[model samples]
Target chain A: AQSVTQPDIHITVSEGASLELRCNYSYGATPYLFWYVQSPGQGLQLLLKYFSGDTLVQGIKGFEAEFKRSQSSFNLRKPSVHWSDAAEYFCARIDSGYSTLTFGKGTMLLVSP
Target chain B: DVKVTQSSRYLVKRTGEKVFLECVQDMDHENMFWYRQDPGLGLRLIYFSYDVKMKEKGDIPEGYSVSREKKERFSLILESASTNQTSMYLCASSGGQAYSNQPQHFGDGTRLSIL
Candidate 1:
């Protein structure tokens, strides 16, 4: 079965610091990868997605992700994090056959002042 | 912009009672999905509909049923609400070819609590 793994369960970073959240997937071939963020009491919002294109894809909220086929990883990165960036981040991949998503357990980002 | 609207923001019900959660989409999307969000589980798919009156079971569909009588409306039914069923339910919709990769638009979510 195809699955997404987010190694870090919780990450605390100082405001204005760089941020990176790691994600790895188990699949034979390159798949459609996505990053989503959810704030407290709110549903998820799409951050970025990677399909058949350049390895790097930019998304809303000044975020971007790189899809590394060799590593089977699609990691999210931001140069400077803000206090408002504190939220839960999920990594997901489209199940090509079913058009459904398989999401990771999620990484909770806490931006400290 | 695609707008997915969930009927309630929060709801409380007793065990064994039937529960109905409503979802509507304005973009006339071809796909609608139901998922439950938990602390460690991230999001688990419950059910989905590709078209009107067509339903399919998802990863976790036990104890849940779905109805998509109209293209714009998809409802999730809990036959017997239980305490373990208390969760944050999310509804999402996506347009375009079923086989193509499309980002799903999500609602604000409904936090359902069963007593």
Candidate 2:
């Protein structure tokens, strides 16, 4: 079975500070990984995804994620945090044969000045 | 840009009422999915359709049913709405088999409140 685990339930960062949200997965193969963000009362928006290739993947809104094979982790990172970046982030992987996604509980990013 | 539209932004219904939440995608994608969002649970898939008239169960499909009579539209039904069923429902679409790599595009979501 494939599952995602985001250890951090919430994280607070100051503006211009670097941010990192950890996501570790349990999978046998190279599963498709994705990062999605959801604002309060809003829908989720795709940040980035890694199917294969370079471990470091760039996404919209200055967000990037690095997939580490040995670590079994795909942690989302942003070099410079902004107030508008505060939202719930979900890490998901497409592992099941049906191409369905298994998501983590999510990490709430709270940006503080 | 791919567009996914949900029929309502907010809804309120009484328990035992049969509720329908509609979603339509104009991108002509072959895969459509419905999910319910709850705090701390992330997103749980309810049902998904690969093509018209074809459906498959997702992670959480016990209290939900689906209809896909047309290619561009999918509907989620709550057989007997319960307070526990109240949640933020999301609809997503992606290109079929050959294009399965495409990311799923989502709608604004419908926040349903059951009384």
Most accurate candidate by lDDT? 1
True contacts kept of each: 0.69, 0.40
Report, for every candidate in turn, its global Cα lDDT versus the true structure: 0.94, 0.92
Per residue, candidate 1 scores C-alpha lDDT tens digits across B8-73 of 999999999999999999998999999999888789999998999999899999999999999999
Tens-place lDDT per residue, model 2, A1-113, is: 78899999999999999999999999666688999999888888999999899999999999999999999999999999999999999998886354677789999999999
Name model 2 segments beyond 4 Å from true. Answer: none
Residues forming the 10-long window of minimal summed lDDT in candidate 2 chain A = A94-103
Q: In model 1, what are the clashing residue pairs, if there are any?
A: none
Question: What is candidate 1's CAPRI-style docking category based on DockQ?
Answer: medium
TM of chain B vs. native, candidate 1:
0.98
lDDT of 2: 0.92
Tell me the docking grade of candidate 2: medium
For candidate 2 chain B, the 10 contiguous residues with the lowest summed lDDT are B96-105
What's the residue-level lDDT of A67 in candidate 1? 91
DockQ of 1: 0.74
Q: Which parts of model 1 have CA positions greater than 4 angstroms off? A: none
Q: How close is candidate 2 to the true structure, as a TM-score?
A: 0.97
